[model samples]
Target: MSNDDAYDNSGHIPDAASYPPRWEAEALAFRHALGPRAVTNWSYGDNVRQVFDLFMPEDPPKGLMVFIHGGYWRRFEPGIWSAFAQGGLDAGWAVVMPGYTLAPEARISRITREIVQALSFMAETVPGPIRLSGHSAGGHLVARMLCGDAMLPAAVAARIEGCVPISPLGDLRPLIDTAMNADLGLTEREAAGESPTLLGRGLDVPVTVWVGGAERPAFVDQARGLAAAWGAPCEIVEGRHHFDVIDDLKDRDSALMRAILG
Candidate 1:
């Protein structure tokens, strides 16, 4: 079997089937708990998918923290991730979660651009230092935002305080021949272009890579490799899986939240 086959996560994580209903339940509960303070369907682009929701703290915000949801650039919704905003909100930081058009319908490159647009919009609207965090493919997108060739303006790029790519897909080349790439439609050029590990080293902003200790080997390797390549620190959350690792973001005092703040 190829490295692509070996690194394929859907094949390795059995609990992948449970994410939606579980996330949906949490999202619904968050809506009930927060009420109108959780703003929904704020448009960033003309497309219906280019929308984001914002969760604000009662007091003035310290900064903006954007959490990008992961579905391998294919599935998941921002609504399902609204509950994760609790930590940032409690920290006196405003949290934004943006939704994007999924793969097959939109290429990875375009999705990257969409995220840039979302961040740019948020940067203009929020007007403060920004911290980015994401899980799985969303982690890939967060890391991609730091790429040297990224489309963000010089001023906007400077506003990026740090990034936390949780359980990120740092190296996309491994997915070219994997089952995961079918919908991603990644070519050699696209994979290399999107892969943060291949994008050079020592970024201007600090980065922290987070991965679940109980996650698949490929995910561990991706997190470790990206940290080593960029000279960033990698935090392994012991006993957490691909899904459970991100749950730490919901706890304001958790290491994951601290990392995001840093």
Candidate 2:
């Protein structure tokens, strides 16, 4: 089936908007509760405008999991989702969250490059294997980071053990037809290039695609498409939605988290 046919969001736009308020509030609370850590800033380019926050563990971690926040490459920043690190921390994993120049200001290609640069920096500075994870738009970015034209350094790529993209948009063409694409300015070619499914499988690394059982059908289908394309496993988180699925990462027994850390 065509992407649009497979993942229809015709009636759930309003529900998608309302999914995040509680999660956002929880994230804010976590941000305030955590003690200070060494914050480092790295720039990809003048126009690209990329920055990442590295939350170092009080003790060294066995590996690092870099999280790319989802905002359709238009809205939201890394700071809002920093609470996610707690899950990694419990698993002895350090976390890196990066912010990229949003759409309308920078194109998708530039944003993708910025993510590559951010990952490159982390690979060089942070010692150990790396796993990638993100939610919604961030989830899409993580999948892109694993596909063709991946700008990651050979060393970093080698050290990447797995990917966990939660409720990702595996394909971008559908967004092109939606109101959300207004700022993205995604041409047909750009959409195809940005799509992980269209690009084919390039990484041998294991990938775990997770979505909330409560999420819009489109998101669940998006996760499934990526899993099918990459020959990875697709998981549905019980009673979760696009906004709250990441919260499961905080629970050690969460199926989504287990797939990621495994």
Candidate 3:
């Protein structure tokens, strides 16, 4: 195997090819069920991909839960992950899944900023505290928001009650040598600058770094490194791998929901 193979989650998992079609079907059914409550294509920027899908709970929302989809910053969109918002929605929170320009089109730095814009818009549209959660590269984006360089409004920053970056890529330096960097287009400088691990202390909010015990060792190290940098809690769920680790996003009673909704 190649040196960068350690970052390859799909290759490590059997039947990985089935995940996309499954997600698409589940997300479609979820949107169909929500009907009007699932607000689609709310734009935060002029770009088509800058839009987000919001899923509101039946009762008044407890707050907002933003789940950013992760595909190494170069794949997937908000709609495909709609089903994942059910956990937050079930918890009486308005859940949002934002789409940003992917790598090869927009730099990771810009994607990070776009999420900030998405959160700011969500803050204006939804009242109450904000909870941030993302899987993989998306986890990197949510963590980036807490960095001072993100420049979130004091009010918006203050409302962020917690962040859970699941199986996150906390550091980017290693990617420079990986094969995906061709599409990621990350220079050494860009990787270092974009790494949440190298950035200064984040906003004063609760943080949890969660990874699957069965995930790639590199990912486990990334979670540990991130938690160490922020002095936060790190959760390693046994028997779970990268793809299945975020499944709890659709379950209200799951530990993931308690961390996000609390």
Candidate 4:
């Protein structure tokens, strides 16, 4: 298989094209139902994409959970993922869904920095332990925060309670040869600097590397590699593929939720 085929999540998932539209529709309705609880347009930077939507629970928040969306760091936005905030909100945690400039417009390094900015911005208002979750490229981004090079503020980094990176690309060097690299703009130099698995050390926050049992082999390898590197637990949800693996996140009582919230 070619490089892209190795990470071709959509081609293998049945009815793959329909998922985004369904997510978009669900997100629209979810935001609408939240009404005043859904705080829109909290800007973290000057760029248009540097805005995030904050979802509030009915009561005061218990803590903060930031769920980053993934499209290989090139697609999707905060608004398209509002529905995913349900599990966190219902569990009494304020959810922050932040948007960053996508690839081809912003390189991965810059995008990582944008996340740092977003994290600091969100932490300013919501006080409590901060947990993280992300899918695909988003998983990579969240992992970046724990790596030494991320340079997250000592104050903000210390508040991170745990991290759950779902189907993360722990190592970006392989992507350097993929067709998506034209858009991702990954390079050996950059990957060496950015790949979480290659880092010598990172923060001591509890990290659980999660991957769907049926996901592409590359993803499973990446997940195991991350867990091994960090000496964290690796949870593989059997029978789930890349796309559906994160569906568990919609249920507040799901194992995925408990793992991240803990």
lDDT for 49 in candidate 4 is 94
**Tens digits of per-residue lDDT for model 4, 152-195:** 99999999989999999889998988898899888899987888
Task: Give per-residue CA lDDT, model 3, range 17-120, as digits (tens).
Answer: 99988999999999999999999889999998999999999999999898998999999999899999989888899998999998889999889889989899
Q: Give candidate 3 regions above 4 Å deviation.
A: 1-3
In every candidate, how many clashes are there? Answer: 0, 1, 0, 0
Per residue, candidate 1 scores C-alpha lDDT tens digits across 18-125 of 877988899889968998788998999998899999988888889999999988898878998888999999998999999999888999999999998999888887
lDDT of each: 0.88, 0.77, 0.91, 0.92
The runs of at least 3 residues in candidate 1 whose Cα sits more than 4 Å from the true structure, single-residue gaps closed, are: 2-15, 201-203
RMSD of each: 1.6, 3.1, 1.1, 1.0
Select the stronger candidate by TM-score from 1 and 4. Answer: 4
Q: TM-score for each prediction?
A: 0.95, 0.88, 0.98, 0.98
For candidate 2, give the lDDT of residue 225: 90
In candidate 4, stretches whose alpha carbon ends up further than 4 angstroms from where it belongs are none
Cα lDDT of model 2 by residue, 23-86, tens digit: 5676667766665753635554455347777777668887888888887787877766767777
